[model samples]
Target: MRRLLPVAFIVFGVISGVQCGFGLNVTVSSFTKSITSSIGNGINLVVKANASIKIAADDDNSGTIRALIAVSNNVTTPLNRLLGSILAAATAENVNSDELFVNIFSLVAETRPALDAASNAASDLQKTTKEYLYQTLSGNLTELSTILTNLTDGLDYLHLQVYQAANEEYPVTSKNITIFINSTVIADITMPLEAIQNYLTHVASVITVIASERTQVIKYLTQMNETISNGLRNIQNSASGFNRTVIDAYHRIMAQQVNTFKNINQTYAAIVSRASSYNGGDISNLTMFLSDLVAANASFLQFVSLSTNYTMEQINPVLQDRIAAATKTLTRVARFIANQSAINISQHANQCAQRFMQKLQQNPVVITRLSRCIQQDSNALQPTVTFVQYQMDLVRSAASSIANQMSKVCQRNTGACARAYFAALPDHSQVIQNKISVIAGVVSNDEHVVTGRIINCLYGTGADIIENALLMTKKFNRCMLVGP
Candidate 1:
């Protein structure tokens, strides 16, 4: 039971951090310092208890308990020093969230050895015959459990502190909000589309070169190459056109909507500022303010509706078409491989198989170009995946902060009205994430099929030929047919 405490606290902290969108705050320094102290004290108690158990187990000639304590000591020294470093690093309130989680995670991982040793020691004492050994081990474990429970209490306090810290009201200004919507929201969304368009153009060029190679021995090789080449071009063109016609247009529409939203927010702020300066006897002024609030809310709702409808009607169908183009390409390549007659073209087929094997071994110009092209494609996409994920972290933080500010205004309204207004706001993070994932998935699936069916099949034919040339064609067909 005591051994499970660390894991539970670690999980609690992680879930709390995630729910807050992992934002940095100006009051987390004290909370980090407090938790670090608790973990340090817990580590010391564990080390002491472990040393006492080792001495007693050695006296009783219990090899199992002695070995456990030795293992525990090996990790204890490093854990102690790392905790000191964490204490030193928490000099400011706005400590990096990633660094704090990493340090906390390190403490949990290193402390696992002591927890496991205690658990095994308790179990071994259950079967011991000597009364002295049982008494010694049992007493120390009780003390250790007490210490762990104290640490658990500290962890609970720290978790609550973190939650409250993350929710502290921030002063939202027009400048900062405009910076967020324009840079973090709009730039993050469109940059990937641009990168992907460039990627498609380059891939099309490489595929065209590979498809133009004339086969000397294999008659069907030319046809299969043409099928793959044409399919890739279709995919490239589909995505390229979609980006120009749909995604670019959507980006412009979103930019216009954000500008409108910014204008409306400024109008609301002006109204509030003016109302605050008025005297209490101005009933007509108060009524005018209420009318302005209603108008602002209506305009905000209209903006949300326009953005949502534009995304659904303009963007979604083009995304589907891009995915469909990729799927169709993969199917055509697979069908071409499946339709080959292995029996009818025996003489030329054998020569063709031998040539394929030779090409893989000698690393000819075609094979070299193909390998480099595949590598280039992977390199292009790897960064997009990482960039999108990093941008999403910022997007989530912005969304949470914006929602917090909006909720304050909503509280002035009736419950049903507040719910309706809050529910209509766009989830920019989720929508963008879903769109990028779909595009990446299409490319990833196409890459898998090409590598497995075409590149790997050729390489396998080489290996099979070395073992038995007669079985090469059969194995090659089998490899191509199992395309993923």
Candidate 2:
């Protein structure tokens, strides 16, 4: 009876444990299915939400909008809580399983409209900012161009004035008033133009208002007007000064030229008078006398050769030497006469040579002639001395006239050179300065244009900024509606 009771009790306990395990297994399986379904639904919702948001952001799409709404409804607290409870019950022994449920629920909950709003806002801000930048840049660029143009014009005027001032053939005094007026105009215009350019370059970085920029542009225009006024004043002042200087210099130069001409004429008269006395009466008579002298010498030489009783040996050496000497003397006389004629024809050339040599003590043309005469008479006799002396005196007078004329020419050229130097000095200096200023202005204007173009390219043109903004907004809306 005791053994039967123990077996019965053991059998009862085993039956009870097996039945309980079966029932627990059924509950676990049901819970596992619920958790699995919830997890799958959560994952699907999350994917749809992200895809919808991404598509919306990427490209406007109606499907993305619908998907986003569906995702929001699917990730409700009731669904999330149900899945959380099942996951907790199924994975009582697994900490990771519980965490996974929490993570999925929180991720879906947090990632809804918050992320979408941020992305949409960022895109809208980008476009708005770019449009604003483009408008500002465009206005600034226009103003900068105007300023640069004014500056360039002013610089051109300055360049012209400098050119006129430096040029030699153009009488500086005669054109002095014009040059002064031009310079003053340039300076006046440049002052305002420079001010405008500087202001534009400096303020361009900081200015925001188109109206303010326009005002600045107006200011520059006013400055240009003022500059013109100032230029006129400067022109008047410079013209007066230039006119006085030019008139004074011109009178002085003319007086000196006249005096030089008078002296040259008197010197030439003296030469003609002296030559007349030497030749017998006048220039024509002198030429005839020279011809007679040549004939007489020829006749005398023939007579000496035929009438002399000297031996051929004695006459040969002396006569030949005399003939050679005579030939040299006559050749020198002919050369002297030719040079004197050349000098008489060109008084300016003679004056130039003489003036240059007066300070140097060396006359190249005179030296060359003298050298030739001496070289030609190298093997001459004493009987040729008179002719040589006469030719030397004639050459000396001709050389003197040449020297005098050369001196006058040198004086004239020196004065001209000095004037040219004085005129060119101011011009060269002004031209360089103007070029540098203009280049700087141009570079600054170029920078403005580049900045404006970049802004326009990145955003849109000033004319189309609003249109582009609306178009971008519409595109963003369509992208948000589509799923990725």
Give the worst 10-residue stretch by lDDT in candidate 2.
1-10
Predicted candidate 1 versus true structure: per-residue lDDT over 1-484, tens digit per residue:
1111221111111111211112333322123433333333424444444434312333323243443344334334444444444344333344564566456556645654554564455455343223333444444444433443433343334434444444447642333333222233323322332332232233223222211211111334434455446544644554344334333433443354345435434534543465433222222433443344345435434543454344335433443443344334333432233223222223343444444344323322121222232332333333433443454344334433433554566554335544443344444334433443443344344334433443443344333323342343355555445421
Q: Show where candidate 2 strays beyond 4 Å.
A: 1-423, 458-484
Error of 1 at 264 (Å): 99
Task: RMSD for all candidates, in order, please.
Answer: 39.8, 46.5
**C-alpha lDDT score of every prediction, in listed order:** 0.37, 0.33
Angstrom error at residue 173, model 1? 18
Tens-place lDDT digits, model 2, residues 1-484: 0000111110000111111010121112222332233234332322222333322212211122322223233323222343334334333432343254455345434533433432332232222222453344334334433444553464345435434444447444432434333335535443543343343333233222222222332333334335334533443443344334333433342343234334434544553555533223334422333343334334433433332212223323432343334334333332222222222223342333233223111222111221222223222222222333343334334323442543444444235433343244334334433432332233334323432333333232222323332343343333334411
